[model samples]
Target: MTATRILLRAIALALLFLPLAGAAAASCGDPATPIARIQGAGDHSPMAGQTVTVEAILSQDSRHQGGFQGFYLQQADHQTDSDPRTSEALFVYTRRSLGEIGDRLRITGTVKEFHGLTELVGIKAMTRCGREPVPAPIVLTLPWPQPPETLENMRVRFEQPLTVIDSHNLGRYGELTLARTDQVNATEYLEPGPSAQLATERQRLQRVVLDDGHRQQQPRPVPWPPGGLTADNTVRAGDRFGQLVGVLDFRFGDWRLQPQATPELLPANPRQPPPARPEQPHLRLVTLNLANYFNGDGDGQGFPTSRGANSQADYEHQHQRLLAALRAPNPDILALTELENDGYGAASSVADLAEALGPSWCVVTTPGADGQDEIRTALLYRSDRVQTSGHAKRLTSGLFRHRGRPPVTQVFRAKNGDTGVRITALHLKSKSCRGATGADQDQQDGQGCYNDRRVRAAEAIVHWLSELPAPDNLAGTLVTGDLNAYAREAPLEVFRSAGFTSMVHQLQPCDARTCPQYTYRYKGARGSLDYALASGSLQPRILTAATWLLNADEPRALAYDGPLDVTSALPWRSSDHNPVITDIRL
Candidate 1:
């Protein structure tokens, strides 16, 4: 007989006795094998390279125009074997043929293991034996009820509420890294090395990403939390939900749940308005990272600049969001990072920002660009509240010139002349690992790369700011901006040793130390990267301080790269870093 005829005859024989799947039976060549037995004992399929028939119900078709080209077949409810440790599901790779969920199908193919996934390929034939009831879902809990290895490809339900610990990829990949509760950044709360190791491991065992099932890039409407993600109704890392039901799938080095439908979430940590005004009539200061504000003359002509908006339209989008965030805190002094290094001319980035902030706001003019960095730190104060008291100074010595955005320090006095405060706006060497070497590379500690450079920059900053002359009537000094180092790192330690009190720790205490309100989220943990540190003279005067949850918690896709996902122009989701707001009597 021909190969096609033999395949057809084999499939015809398998259909005769497949309904008796729980019992041993021989209806096709070499008899039939149980899917659980094929997946027995280890991570690899034991029946690999052998042809066999298995009866299953098609649970989902993961095939589209440009898709996975396969369908998931799971053992029916009535046909499951006695072995509870073995999963009852299998993946059948069929590029040309299609099947629907609930279709009872017996497939005859050669078992194969591709990239750790047990699947059937070289499919000879598939026989539809009519539909049966879908397998009943097994109930489970977060922090995992058991090792998920046995539950691979099986439908499960999570009735326990899961918190949104990390939504970094919600917009990019339609993924949600959820946990039993909001997770903490290890380095933020613990020391860098051995202490962080334990935290990192704990984070790993507790995470499971929820994927949208499609592998395509940039889906217009992100699928999650029942409703599409929006600016006002957005989900953050600390949000929570009551229940989630989906198929547990492992792929690309992570365990993901492909939800049958969108999971409805109860907003545990919802979008918050900007920081409130200080109790008394005092100065409110805000530190923000502009997220690269570059305007290209209202057109897309400028092909490339160092960093920022790609076109004029892109610039407007970035600008509007940034302006909204900057103004939301109702700050008297706005200390900023990541402003374009373009000069203070009419078309300058900082100049345009001042223009949008209304007539009373003014940018403190530097003698020239703050060193040669592509972006510089700046100070913008409301003229109605505070006025520049002295010429701005930039740290040009040591690590500031090469590895960091030079710190910009300017003394500002209240318009009524009650007192003055030295606001030092700093943008430090980033913690990125690109091109790093020696002590700069990841020390394995949770500090990541460039911890050394950031440390040196911090030390230099302390020395430089200490020597500067404080303006007359100055009550205290405040250091604010992106330190680019976490709370437990060497940089903050240097500031601590120099008698600077971290207001973040003061307002929101993590432990004995001041672990400020987190302004940044990375790799599934939330912690502070921006801070407001006050000198001893100013520390006692600080009334209240907090991180305005406008940026870091929001999805990255809401930024200028995509179409305007939000239109209200509020501070929420304006930049990658949340603004640090401090209300001080000084």
Candidate 2:
């Protein structure tokens, strides 16, 4: 017989046995193998690589364009084997779109495991026997009582509330990492040791991704938060939801929930306004990470600079947002990090920013003092509120000579005859592991790469500030900017051991499970990378310290790169890191 005749004969035979398959299914007897038996009680299928016939109900049809190119089959109600240890559902992969949910299907195909998902492919025969009741969705909750593998490919409903811990991939992949509660960085609370190791492992068990059902990237209308995603309407990391009805699917190395019904999201963490200016008469200092402020030649021509904005329009928008944030606190001195490393010329980025802040604002600069890195730390003071007491100093020797950016220190005095207070702006080596070597590489202790270098930098900052000439060292000192280390990390520990108190910690203490205050958010975890640390002599003078919620909590979709996503000209999300404001009575 010809190939086409053989295929037609097989289809006719499949149709001939369709009624028998339905009768056996209704009687809970099978000419087809039981799905649970095929699944077994293990991660891999016991019937893999074997051709088998199965009668099941269609639970999900995903054969449309942008779908998963397949359909899900589950054993009909009251037809499942009495085993909770094995899933009773299987994914049927085929190009043909056939049958609706609740339609009973008798299919013969080779059972195979496709990238960890147990599925049937290369079908030889398929027949829609008749309609059968859809399988009841199994109820599941966070902190799973059983392995997800046992429930894999089954229709499950999560009724307990799940917190949205990570939304970083929401815009790109249409996925959200949800957990039983808000998750924190291990090193943010516990020291790097056995305790931290346990915390990290616990975090892994608590996570499950919520997928948008479609398998495409950057879905047309971003899903979640009930309505589609917009510049102003966002699904932030801290949002909460009570219920989710979906299929438990494992794909791309993560166990995800492909929702059959839209989950209701609650705005647990809402957008907050910029902090109000302090009322008491005091000297306010603000430390901010510019998130790499680079002006292309300080003109409108520099497109696609090394670090920051990619275009002239992007650069202007970033500058405008930053200015709004800077003006909100009405700070007397600004310790800034990640400014362009250009010279102190009239066309420099710092000069342009200073000019924008009015004539009373002037940057503390020494000719040829800025480091050779692409970005540097800077100190800008309000000339009307305080006067420069001594020449600005930069530390260029030791580890900072090549490892980290050189820190700039400037001593300032209140115009009303208050004592001088020296402030040092610092930007340490980041956690990126590219080209890291020896002890500087990630030790896997949760401190990340270049931690040893950052610890050495912290020590150097302490010693360098103490060794400054006469009047510079005589004044009370405040060290502030992005340390690129969490609260309990080794770098911050070095500063604490040196008697420099963390102003934010002194204000609001954190425990092992919860940290309410943070200046940065990464991969859905919140921690303080930007801090205001004060020397022993300066601690008592601090009146209040706060991290304004202008940046970290906001969505990145509102950033400068995507102009259509920019809804407002407000200071929210002006930078990736939030500004830490400190009020001190000098």
Candidate 3:
């Protein structure tokens, strides 16, 4: 053949066997477009709903039965541009396996945005030609950044040791919140306002999630926290982990790290036993959230009455769990919330609990009214240790009637001496944004919903208590209950402004103590939503204020109503909020 004809034949043959779907370098063939261009410097996919060919290395594969049904694809080379606002990766949705990590392959898919995540759907999988080096991860240090837009959908590594601040969805979603250190309430440092806004921003900048590298629901054994979480082997907020390396994924309205592999846990903050009594002569007060204690019926026939237990057996189980928690602390006074608002009639909630605790326990009756609400605050005391010295007082004015459960207070004088303390119990509006409106809506400042209402209710409580006549021999006063506000929240600020100091903060400051400093874990961040604010008089008398890890720290499967093998009558997972115990000398 002629020299030109022979060269043309050789070129045509090479084209036929070149592997069209392979992700070879541009010099070898027509290389696919880089992934960074597809994911622009915004919250959306630049080529949404459009088909595009891209060559990339798979960073994560969660296509297991219950996972995200796909894998994360990131740029394999150091081809990232100087613009720090753009993403270097994207999620590819598919029903089958595409390729393994470092395997370079060309993918043809339609770009789409799912909820808050930018991904590629309708993916056409291709076989791997050869493995390419995975891109180096972005180093995220402590105090991440106010805006993480630039790092979204990118592989990153935690430069600092990140502690698990919240693990509410550990069992359900296999996810937990990680922070530079143990997390705190924004409201605790400053009330919800402009400063609260700044603090909230700081917290957001400091926190990120460490998600189980799965997208499925209810993975039998949660993938994170090392071994599966248990009652005794619980994972608390202060629990620390080694340096983290994962893909930064933004979904469900938050930034999360889909870890490449399970990192070893430090177990620095494990489940702890109830604190021992202090040496000083004092009264032990316990404030617990019942997680919605609803008695089925006065005669135990009311299965699935309204909220809590689903059946008679469930009620019995819940009762046993709560009873264990209340008595385990050996408390002289118990401030409880979310109890069944069944009246003081026979077989009522209080009567049942009081009977279970024997004759020594007596519940303070609130005149003739049990406010018209599904749940209410309650006070119970060991009559042998202290006797009621004044009539019980309940708040009943204005918004307190609707948004706030009327706080109940009573004076208790020590049985053997004149020293006494008055206690007020309240349940404030929750941060849930179900029906939030106006200023009550979440301001996205880290303080959740209903913050404004909680602030207003706190004002009422402070005003009412200021006017309350001190009963005989009262040496101090304590305002304890579920403020439904985190530390530094507006409501908590109101209480602080009214001269009430958070006992937990006074005793165990997060900066000073390695132990966890939170009462509730929501979503994935830990903070003190349940509080025991003491007056100046009571604050000094306090010897210790601590939270018992009966709940929140442990997984939901350990609850009384959870699955059989893990369920029990133990105090673990008794409630959603950890019970706060205060040891004080009146």
Runs in model 2 lying further than 4 Å from the true structure: 1-30, 469-475, 562-567
- What lDDT tens digits, residue by residue, belong to model 3 across residues 1-586? 9999999999987775443333233332245656666777777877787776776778767787767888888876566665677787888888766578777766777778888788878766455657878878888786765357677677888876787777767777887787877655555555566776675566666677788777767776766657776555666667788768888888887788888777768876666679999877888899999988887786878878788888878888888888988889899989999988888876888888888888999999985466788889999999899888868989898776654578999888767768778889999888789988999899877677888788788898899999998866677789999988777566777888888998897777653124366787665456687888899877878888888876876667668776424445688788888998988786
For every candidate structure, what is the RMSD over all alpha carbons to the true structure, in angstroms? 5.4, 5.6, 4.9
Model 1: worst 10 consecutive residues (lDDT sum): 21-30
Q: Model 2: how large is the Cα RMSD against the reference?
A: 5.6
C-alpha lDDT (0 to 100) for residue 576 of candidate 1: 85
Best of the candidates, TM-score: 2
Assess the local accuracy of residue 485 in candidate 2 as a C-alpha lDDT between 0 and 100: 95
Clashes of each: 3, 0, 7
Off by over 4 Å in 3: 1-29, 41-45, 48-52, 56-59, 72-99, 108-127, 131-139, 145-155, 395-404, 432-472, 486-500, 508-516, 536-540, 561-565
Instruction: Using lDDT, give the best candidate's number.
Output: 2
Off by over 4 Å in 1: 1-31, 64-67, 77-85, 95-100, 231-233, 297-301, 401-403, 511-516, 563-570
lDDT of 1 at 473: 78
lDDT of 2 at 303: 74
lDDT tens digits by residue: candidate 2, 1-586: 9999999999987865553312233232336777887788999998798877788999978887888988899988788887879999989999876789888998878889989999989877778888887888888888997899988888988878799887677777778889888877788888987788787877887789999888998775778666877766777777887678878888998899988888888888887755666666678898999999998898787779999888887888889889988988888899999999998888888998999988999999966767689999989988988888868889988877664689998888888554788888999999999989999898878888999889989998889877887574344788899999988999999989988888887888666567767888877677899999988988888887878867776666667664235735668778889899988876
Q: Model 3, 67: alpha-carbon shift in Å?
A: 3.7
lDDT (10s digit) by residue, model 1, range 1-586: 9999999999988876553323333332323567787777577777788777887888877876645678788888876785777888877888846458898777778888887778888877777778788888889886777777777788888878787767767777788888777667777778788878887788878888878887776665777656677665577777776657777877777788877766778876667787678677688888888877666542356745558776565666677777777776788889988887877887778888898999999988885547787788889889988877768888887776554678888887778775888889898778788999999998888788888888888888889887887666788889999988888888899999998988877768774223337888887777888999999989878887888777776777666665434545556667888888888886
Model 3 error, position 22 (Å) = 15
Q: TM-score of predicted model 1?
A: 0.90
Candidates arranged by lDDT, highest first: 2, 1, 3
